[model samples]
Target: MITKQSVIGFIGTGVMGKSMARNLQKEGFPLHVYTRTKEKAAELIEHGAVWKNSVQELAASSDVIITMVGYPQDVEEVYFGEAGILENAKEHTYVIDMTTSKPSLAVDIYRKAKEKNIFALDAPVSGGDIGAKNGTLAIMVGGDEDVFQRMMPIFEVLGENIRLQGGAGSGQHTKLANQITIASNMIGVCEAIVYAKKAGLNPEKVLESISTGAAGSFSLSKLGPRMLKGDFAPGFYVKHFIKDMTIALESAKEMGLSTPGLELSLRLYKELAEKGEADSGTQALIKLFE
Candidate 1:
């Protein structure tokens, strides 16, 4: 039996946030949502969500606050900066940031939440926009075990995989690992499909063959097909993925760690963005080569 009294508040509605909030609504949770782009909040509002005029207002009224903004800075601004969650924090607030952002930022926010006696979890997620739309993200969470337990039901609503990595920034760091693997795999899919196109072997057919082999991956199977058809309408914006990569690089440098593969991915994504597909979905990265 879950507590029905908890009202869920969500920030960042561009893609993931919208779907996640809608899922909560479907599960019979009263939802309040705040988005920088107010227009994006329309569909969710139609689904029975109340429009939170601002992050602070959302923070004030909700029992649990979830964030899924685009970048590390956006996460920071919504949670701790002016007009942010902290501006309207009340006792016993549970704040979860599900953005794929820098680990250190997660740590800083966690500490701030603790000082205010609020429960904060750094819970970055995977599974992209498609998953969000379908209510199946993979959540990597870090915080107190009790709080993690408290959030499990909500996690079950939003993600397929709900993992507890460690405390404070562990979720974000784990998400970095997830991003690193994705960077490599996305590049792999792009290269393989590009080669198939050049060879006139039918990129889709080649994908059908290898997608069941050891090279099989979610990217190669789902996103690879999308890339092949040039359907890059933002399953996770290239711009947003690049921002996540930048967060990974910054965190790696701070830890005195080196990631050459991620560096190459950064460069490739930068070039892709430079070619003007940054606003497109991560699959649109293949456009750089086309």
Candidate 2:
């Protein structure tokens, strides 16, 4: 039921956020944008998006506010601080956080927003930069069913696969599960290429063979090509991936579960980070073998 007149305030303009916000603009939604560095948001402003003075100002002005920021701490600062979203948004405003963050934080945001008579959803996404650019992200949502249903039209413009997993923090929990798989899968993708090189097989041909079979995955098909091409520019940052793995590990421990593969992946990624590869794209994991 959200129309083009529903002003959208978007905080975060890096990587995927830029494209995601652009898609909303393309859908004719009036957009208000803000980022730490105003220069980073210039592109959106040039494309008819309005610039906001601060998070508080943006929250006060928009009908729906979406945040896709970095790290759990950033999420906390923007939502829980004195002049934050929960403090300034009007009653019944929809606040959707698309950041991959701690589930407990998401639940806390939901509870806090509800106390203010606001509608909130934790909607974490996957599919990376390509998906963001192509408007095909898989959005996992956790919130009231009624609010989710009302937001479906907006979700449709921003993503292809959208699902409501449960209430409050469930979307973040689901995203942590996703990160667990990607952590191990990235290792597998790197190893498969390494093994191919060791055995004197063309890694590209190996990719051709395995990518269509049971070994196929989003990482193998997409990131594998970037690896073969030696393009390590980040579609997703190694540092961010490490943060995700750390969260997943913490959450798993809370549940009294063990994730050995996740543990191994985190160790290796931390090694890469120590090597100063933190800003490089996640496909750079293959460089550990080379």
Query: Which predicted model would earn the best TM-score?
Result: 2
- Models 1 onward score TM values of 0.96, 0.99
What is the per-residue lDDT of model 2 for residues 13-65, given as tens digits with 9 covering 90 to 100?
A: 98999999999999899999989999989989999999998999999999999
TM-score of 1: 0.96
How many clashes in candidate 1? 0
The lowest-lDDT stretch of 10 consecutive residues in candidate 1 is 1-10
Q: After superposition, how far is residue 165 of candidate 2 from its true place, in Å?
A: 0.2
Query: What lDDT does each candidate get?
Result: 0.86, 0.95
For model 1, name the residue pairs that clash.
Answer: none
Tell me the spans in candidate 1 whose CA falls farther than 4 Å from its real position: none
**Runs off by more than 4 Å, candidate 2:** none
- Tens digits of per-residue lDDT for model 1, 82-159: 677876779789999988887888888989888889899999888877888788888999889999998888999898
